[model samples]
Target: MIEVKQLTKRYGGTTAVKDLTFTVDPGQVTGFLGPNGSGKSTTLRMILGLHEPTSGTVTVEGRPFRSRPRGLRHVGSLLDAQEVHGGRSAVAHLSALARSNRIPRRRVDEVLERVGLAEVAGRRIGGFSLGMKQRLGIAAALLGDAPVLLFDEPLNGLDPEGVKWVRDLFRGLAAEGRTVFVSSHLMSEMEHTADQLIVIGRGELIAAESLEEFSARGTRQSVMVGTPDTEILRDLLAAEGAAVRADGRLLTVTGLSAARVGEIALVHRVPLHHLSTRSGSLEEAFMELTADSVQYLAGEPR
Candidate 1:
């Protein structure tokens, strides 16, 4: 488990992270999410001891990271896949990291194969594709067989297949009782990949909850109905306290179910053409939940 308490960071007069506190539990994939420049990267840097926090503390298990250089054996992280030496082969890089930390040499081959990089073990890092680089990064993170893993945009340059592969890897890790924390800007990816979410905005915590809880209480549902007499149906639905909007050949209605809509069309002598129900999507919920915290909003009225 990773615990952060009252963590804050400042650069001169500007605050980057403010009294942030959250815990990442094991056996679940926790998504660290925020808009651009919202201090998500800064917080991760602090956790890794790359940047000293202006105040507060972060601990893995119960020990400070710096106090325990071997602590990484329990908490593996992949912040940048391209940070490796360009001259080294994939196997060489992992072997060097393990040698430096006194990790066994055999573990290098194990993780390489685990992340599907064993086929390219002899290839130089400079010649590897972005997807291959990502795989190598995962191998490095798993070299110590860590129970807690942190990934920052692991799918950044991956194709559709690579994206799916990373998603499955994360899920598989969490299923094995490991703590998986990932930070990404892609809402679609997070929607399907994460079991829990830790959202931050403007250097403050926005929410820390399950995805189900984040999207559970929606006030409106999207309902689509097709009918030749859309106008008559719209009037009937509106009179029944439902908001109705007509779009081309279909009528969009809220506050009414497909069964009720069919009965309304039948009783009103309007022919029912089609009916479908759409619950709000995770993308919609994310936007609504983080609108105020978005640092940049495009096409704003000037």
Candidate 2:
């Protein structure tokens, strides 16, 4: 598990993170979400001990990560896939990390194969595409077989297949009781992959809870109703203080529940063809919750 308590970081007069407290438990994938310039990268660096916190503390598996020898053996992180030496072969790069952490040289080959880079093990990283480089970085993270892994935008340059593979890989690792923390801007991917979420904005914690709970925080719940008497139902629903939008025989309703809509329709003897509730998606929830936290707002397109 990873624990952060009242963590804060400052650079000169600017505060990058403030009093952030959260725990990333094992046996599940936790997503780190925030808008641009929201201090996500800064927080990740602090967690890896790359940046010192002005105050508070961070620990992996009950102790400071910097206090542990062979850090990779405990926490594996991929902060930047492109940070590796471009001239080195994939195998050579993994080999160096393995040797530094006193890991077996053979483990390099295992991780390379696992990440689908064994075929290009001898190729120089400079010649690889962005996606290939991402794979190599993932290989290095797996080199130590660490129980706690942290990834920042691991899906940045991946194809659909690679993305799916990564999703499955994280799930597999969590099933084995490893702590998997992922930081990504892709809400759809997080919706499918993460079991929990840690949301921050402007260096402060917004939410730290299960994915379901966070999603449920969105207030844009609506009911979809299909009826032949679309105009009649629209007027009837409007009378109940519900906003209703009509498209032919279908009506989208807000400020009401599916059961209530059904009741209203039945009471008025309006036959209904279909009725279902539609909850807001993760992206919608994120946008709504982080609206004020966004640093750069674009104006309407011309």
Candidate 3:
């Protein structure tokens, strides 16, 4: 597991992260979410010991990452897929990492094949597309077979198939009791992949909870009701303090449950064609929760 407690970082007069505390447990994929300039990259850097915290602590498996000699054996990370040398072949690049970490040379081939890069193992990275580079980066992360892995935007340039492959890979890794922490902007993907979430905004911790719990924080719950007596039901529901929006025979209601709507409709003898509850999505929850934390705002278009 990875533990961060009261972690803070400052560059000159600017504070990037402040008193951030969260634990990424094993046996599940934990998603790291934040808006742009929210210090997500900074926090990831600190966790990998690439940046020193001005105060507080972050540790993997009860110790700082820097304290580990062969770091890749314990923590593997892919901060930037584009940071690799473009002149080297995929195999040669991974081979160097394996040698530095005292990992077996054969492990390079295994990771390459696992990431679907074995066919292009001899190709120079400069010739690879962004998606292929992403695959190669994932291969490097898996080279050491580390217990803990951190990925920043691993799905940045992946196609639909590659995205699904990555999702399955992370799940498989978690099933093996490895700590999988992913940082990405794709809420739909996180909704399907992550078991838990660590949400931050403006360098401050907003939430660190299960995906369900975080999603429940959104206040946009509504019940969809289709009825011929829309006007009558709308009036009746309005009397009960429910906010209702109507489109012909359909009524979208907030501030009430589907069961309550059904009961009200039945008591009023209102004919109903359909009734269903619509819970807020992860993207909706993120937008509502992080509204104030957004650094750049675009004006509404004309």
Candidate 4:
């Protein structure tokens, strides 16, 4: 488990992270999300002690990360996928880390096979593609066989297949009672991967909740009706206290379900051409939630 309490960091005139607080628990994948320059990387760095916070603290397993005995054995992290030496073979690279940490040399091979990089164990990292490097980074993270894992943008350069592989891998890890904390800018990608989300914007914590709950808060069950008798249907629905928006041939109705909308049309005797419920995409809900606090907002029209 990892806990960040009122964490804050500043760089002279600019604040990189602000009083952020969140807890990552075991047995689930917690997704961290924000736009670029939103201080996501800065927060991760602070958690791992790579960046000293101006205030607040981060702890791993109930104690400060630095003070925890055999801390790396409790937490495995992949902040950068290209941290390995280009000249070194994959096997040799892992071997060096394992030996330095007094980890069994067998773990190197085990994790190499685990990440499906066993065949390329002898290949130099310089010859590997971005996806291959990402896998290698994952292999290194698992080399410790730690209970907690933190990955920042592990899907950045991966192909679709690789993305799914990583997604499944994270779920598998959490299923085995490990704590998986992953960060990414793609909301759609994290939609199914993470059970909970910790969202931040403008260097501050915005919202943290279960994925389903978060989406539900931003939207509700609504139905869209399309018919030629738009004027009549709108009047009927409006009289029933349903919020209606008419956009060309489509009418968006809120505060009513699909079945209710159908019943309303039947009662009013309005000929309905098409009626269906419209569900909001998780990405849309996320964008709307962080719109005001987004750090890199587009310029307004002149």
Best model per lDDT = 3
Best by TM-score: 2
Instruction: For each candidate in the order shown, give its overall lDDT on alpha carbons.
Output: 0.87, 0.93, 0.95, 0.88
Model 3, range 155-255, lDDT digits (tens) per residue? 98999999999999999999999999999999999999999999999999999999999999865899999999999999999999999999989999999
Scored against the true structure, residue 212 in model 2 reaches a CA lDDT of 87
Q: Candidate 1 lDDT, tens digit per residue, 47-126?
A: 88889999999987777777766755877899999998989999999888898778999999899888788888998999
State which candidate, 3 or 4, has the greater lDDT.
3
Candidate 3 weakest ten by summed lDDT: 293-302
Kindly report which residue pairs in candidate 3 clash with one another.
Answer: none
Q: Write the per-residue lDDT of candidate 4 for residues 203-237, one digit (tens) a residue.
A: 99988999988887876767999988888888888
Clashing residue pairs, backbone N/CA/C < 3 A, model 2: none
Off by over 4 Å in 4: 68-71, 224-260, 267-278, 299-302
* Cα lDDT of model 2 by residue, 1-302, tens digit: 99999999999999989999999999999999999989999999998889999999999999988898899899998999999898999999998999999999999989988999889999999999989988888888888899999999999889999999999999999999999999999999999999999999999999999898888896589899999999999999999999999988999999999999999999999999899999878898899899888876779453
**Per-model TM values vs. the true structure:** 0.89, 0.93, 0.91, 0.86
Ranking by TM-score: 2, 3, 1, 4
The predicted structure with the larger TM-score, 1 or 3, is 3
